[model samples]
Target: MRLAETVTFGGSDLDRCAAERKDAATLARNLAEGGQVIVLWRGKPLVAGDPAKGACRLVRLGAEDPILRDAEEGAIFLGRIEGQAIFAMDISGWTPPEPVDEAQIGAFLDPTVQLHPGAPEGSAFRELRAIMTTLTARDAELAATARALGNWHLSHGFCSRCGVASAMTEGGWQRLCPDCGAHHFPRTDPVVIMLITRGERVLLGRSPGWPEGMFSLLAGFVEPGETIEAAVRREVFEETAVRVGRVDYLANQPWPFPASLMIGCRGEAISEEIAIDPAEIEAARWVTRSELLQVFAGEHPEIRPARRGAIAHFLLENWLADRLD
Candidate 1:
């Protein structure tokens, strides 16, 4: 796990200026001088060129960029790099030029890309998952932060405590209810995705609605009082009836598919039998390391590997190369 930070969305080293967020004057000055502003639309980030190519990258706009005027909310400070401040803004209020299929939009890694008339030439808004692996470490974190924070503000417009509408404050990091003295912060649900192994085979499962032949490491949310180790064991047992004996943390990635922290773990399975709960997963099976190699290469006949940017894929890649230690 020494190279944990190398995982997508984990190694950005963003200098999130926590103290400056509270200083109104300093924040205003930074916004005035900050030239790096990443734009998102309906949870999709704006990128330039063909993201499938190595040369493609994010197009972080200046603070004065007119496209940012359509942002439904205020600018969010996403830290800095080399003395230049970076910000993220969601222009979800703007509509795309073409009529989009509501069903295909992120239903399964949304293949549809959108272009705005005012956006930069060759720039288009695309689902972050589609372009996450192609982005630099910095852009990956920026997109994750933007999507997660924007989703939080959109879904949490009301105070849970008093059922009152809240206002964005603290540089879009905190929400304050005017009626009550309630304050809310962004939420990141911790999910444990375990690589369960028995001898040379690893446990894999496909959810009920996943695309055909898709399988991934078993995963579930960490309950309120459960530890990481306990969550891994419980989730594996619950989903596949596989009892995990020992669990160790492997790495973590900021999965902003609506704000999640994917905690990758390695678990030694004491049992090989898989009795998948139909309600939890559509199918469960064991695959050998050799089979995994085929799956990663897109040569496997039945199963495709997890998405490239996912923690599951990262863990599997390292495990295959004997770099998990």
Candidate 2:
């Protein structure tokens, strides 16, 4: 897909200074010199303004900011933006003054516009997924990087090899285990999300607990020792008993709901018969181009289009418009 990277959260080419991450003294200096920080509370980013107008604001702070006093761990160096250093701090343990809104669509809620005890009054922790489509490319990339790296540090605090707790090192890029001398890096699980085509129809499936009428491309995690193409084929077969062939890579998106790399692909379906595995998916079906266009137009009563900002939606939209070249 020529315009593949134009997808939401796909195009920002931030200079992730990998080499600088290893220099503790430089990182400390950056912090001491008043580097800006992005704050994440319980995996939700602090937003400062309205998201509907394409200004999904990210709260940036300085090192001595009062909010950092209660940060759970040292800041993660997130690289430089326009010659200024960027960092991420997590204050997951801090209690919010207001109860979190549970009826929000995504994992976290857009906090009430009120003053927290120690934080800025206008800022509110909001789920990245809930506002991803509205954010600028830079904000989306930065938030995704922070959320992914932060989630890794939170979940992989223990060493997998020696069963020992690991300490954060290398500016939150690596973990060091004292007991086993093992070095652990942040993990990004690769998932294959493929659009399977048989003539004029594309395959889509719905999971068990998904909202009624919601469906998306068949996707599954890449198993160990499995190639991306192999994973795509395996996932399609496992979920819907649809045999896929001639797989081709399309585009990718950083899906930071607990850290995943969504590898988008297009696959040719050799067999049209769908024998859906009830355990893997609640339902599976193939829809024609016209029918999908209806779905996108909100005219299909039985199916809701894939959520915007997701790679699935991106792929399907491009495919419908014949732009997946």
Candidate 3:
């Protein structure tokens, strides 16, 4: 899509100094010396400061009013943000005040806390994706990293093999079992999201409980040992009874809502039969490029365009502009 990479978290070529992961002390010292500055508040990063100018603040743990922390407990050296060294701190342990109702979460969801220290944060912090355009590329990548690693710790606290509690290791990337000596690493499940086209028309589906009129590309999790092409075809067929052929990988996005890597593809539909799988989807149909254009423009009577920032939207926008090829 012409605006594919323009989505939230689209990416800004942030330096992710992966080569320095092994040297924690040097990296931490480098960060304290004021080279990089971008911190995440519940996964939303603060991109407003100038680290090289020493305009950033690092709140010590247990300090009076600290909004962020080192995300890995150890430093994960994020490359420079406009020539400043960016380091992410994981503050996943902090909990917020009790909520009286849903509206309370609104105050808790503000993005400014990323810039300010301790404007009241929460334990359920996640990667900041909604306001991606306003964030720097360094901040976006750090937020994604924080969300992915934190989720791994949450879901894999217990070992699958021995049913024992696992300890964080490898700078929060791996979990080690003390009882059985088993090693576990963070997981990123693969999902196939495809724009299935049959000439001028494409396939779209709406899952149960989504907003009315909302439709998106057919998607499903890739089965174990399955190839990307196979997963695309299988998911499309199983959901809508549409046989897809000639799958071509288009793009990919790292979705850290508990960790998923969306594999975007363009698939050619061999048949146009509509047989919705009741358990998986509520409705499926072929939508012409013209109709999709209307939906994108918010003029369609029955179907709404996919949510912004989602891979489906990216694919559809590109397809409509004849850029998906």
Best model number under TM-score: 1
Against the correct fold, how does model 2 do in TM-score? Answer: 0.94
Question: Residue 257 lDDT in model 2?
Answer: 85
Q: lDDT, candidate 3, residue 284?
A: 92
Of models 1 and 2, which has the larger lDDT? 1
| Model 3: per-residue Cα lDDT over 1-325, one tens digit each | 3445665555767666566555656656666676443344444343433433523222222221245443434444446656666544555455445332334324423322322334433222322544443344445555676667655666678998999988765445567899999999778899999989999999999998677889999998999999999999999988999998899988888877658888899999999989999999999989998899899999999999887667788888888877865
Residue 243 of model 2, lDDT score: 94
After superposition on all C-alphas, the RMSD of every candidate to the true structure, in Å, is 1.3, 2.1, 5.8
lDDT of 1: 0.88
Which residue pairs in model 1 clash with each other?
Answer: none
Task: Give lDDT tens digits, candidate 2, residues 1-325.
Answer: 8888888779576788889989999999998797999988867888887776667778898899998887878999988877789999998777777766556523233434333566676667777877888788998999999999988888888999998999899999999999999999988899999999999999999987676889899999999999999999999998888899899999999888888999999999999999999989999999999999999999997999888889999999999988888
* Of 1 and 3, the candidate ranking higher by TM-score: 1
User: TM-score, each model?
Assistant: 0.97, 0.94, 0.78
Evaluated at residue 183, the lDDT of candidate 2 is: 98
* Segments of candidate 1 deviating more than 4 angstroms: none
